[model samples]
Target: LAIAHQYVTQGGLDYAREILESALGPRKAKEILEKVQQTIRTTGFNLLENVDPKQIVNFIQKEHPQTIALLLAHMEPKNAAPIVSALPQELQVDVATRIATMESISPETLDQVEEVLVSQIKSLFGGDVSEIGGVKAVAEMLNSVDRGAEKNILGNLERENPELATEIKNLMFVFEDVLLLDDRSMQRVLKEIDTKDLSMALKGASEELQEKFFRNMSSRAAEMIREDMEFMGPIRLKDVEEVQQRIVDVIRRLEEDGEIIISGRGGDEDIVV
Candidate 1:
């Protein structure tokens, strides 16, 4: 029963229940299954979620945009984001547009896509498909991707589908978008950031962004940050990006907690008060 319950939580509910029914009578298995269902929230079963994003990217890169969109739409945004980022810039925009504008995919279509995915990744097991994709999903996926890819995709998307692009852009908040915060919100965000991370993150920041943070800090503290960055010398772009992402995550968390407000851009209406 414990093992079966574990399987249920790990996205093998049907297989778990089937084995339980064989080991125990239908009545016993049914009772156990019912209890597990009531106690645990399943994210539905998706073997694709466990596969490495790089492997998925290699297999799907040559596929049609719509086919790639269908697979990514079914995946968790975190997993899907990297795969999208890894694609060629042109394909990235094509797939993102498909995901944003995508509607419900018929089960027949899903089955066909699923077969292709499973056959390519052979180790992937069958699992249930739930509804996914649209502007919100695209936004979430874009939010996880690197700034360069995000900008490139959105730029192309803006030309291809202006309305849809605006909707997606409205939902996203990139690392550089921290500049959208007011002085009060920026200070609040700064208080939560580590000095080391701030220095590293600012290494790759634009002059305008550096000034935004500097203006919020005491003159002495801002000078110290500049000294640290100057002494650090050449740093890997990947390391800089990682630290910037962490700082952006802090900003998003503070915003979610209502401790800060990110002002609107991309023609969003300004706050009245």
Candidate 2:
């Protein structure tokens, strides 16, 4: 709970931690709250004059019974509950004494807290899967890694800091992974291109690949392309845009394979003969 308070103070209270807590199995959430707050508190500072540990322990021990109950629930029932159970006789008596004198909590407050937890949980975990790290990162990380290992990492990430992990997943698209299209969709896509330019764009590309493109194209257009290959010349800039739009996904695949070179905008002096 102290760590959680520190997290809110540092990160401006986007309610990320609360949402994280909701997702954790009671124990893990408690662990993550402590871990994340530790990360935030130590992020920018070195050690300073130590405050009294007794004060820290007392603050938690002497809080209102209801508040302490809620806070301990934030902790894992295993470790935290045991500590609460084993509290010094005086502290337990003090908390019970306080609880006996307290007024009843309003039902409205419980409703509000439940609503906040639900809304925040969805917001924190919500994500767009399409934009994950460039195909490179996921593939690299998963190499030789098992699904169970990945699951554990993702679960821990979701608990402590979900926003960052969601962003990582969106920015990557390892290999031709649907990232491109399923093999069936590739057939429909090849149908949309002019075979001659397709073949030329594919020049130095593989025979099997060229055939893949042609087989998917309209037969008459494929014939026209076979006859007109010679007439096609260096791609015009205006046409490059049009042409590139047609093959960008394919080019990305080719680029990934290290099979083609693509020049970029540069001054005349930077261009080689």
TM-score versus the correct structure, for each prediction: 0.51, 0.25
Give the Cα error of residue 215 in candidate 1, in Å: 15
lDDT by residue for model 1 (1-273), tens: 567779786767788788888999899998888667533422222567787878878888988999888778877888888898899999999999989988765545655665666665654322233455899999988877766687799889888889998788666777789788999998898899999999999999999999999999999999999999999999999999889878877886786565777664221233456
All predictions: root-mean-square deviation over Cα?
Answer: 14.4, 21.9
The superposed Cα distance between candidate 2 and the true structure at residue 23, in angstroms, equals 62
True-vs-predicted CA distance for residue 190, candidate 2, Å: 2.9
After TM-score superposition, the amount by which residue 127's alpha carbon in candidate 2 deviates from its true location, in angstroms, is: 34
Q: lDDT for each of the candidates?
A: 0.79, 0.42
Those runs of model 1 whose alpha carbons end farther than 4 Å from true positions after fitting are: 1-45, 123-130, 174-273
Candidate 1, 94: how far from true, in Å? 0.6
Winning candidate number (lDDT):
1
Q: Backbone collision count in every prediction?
A: 0, 13
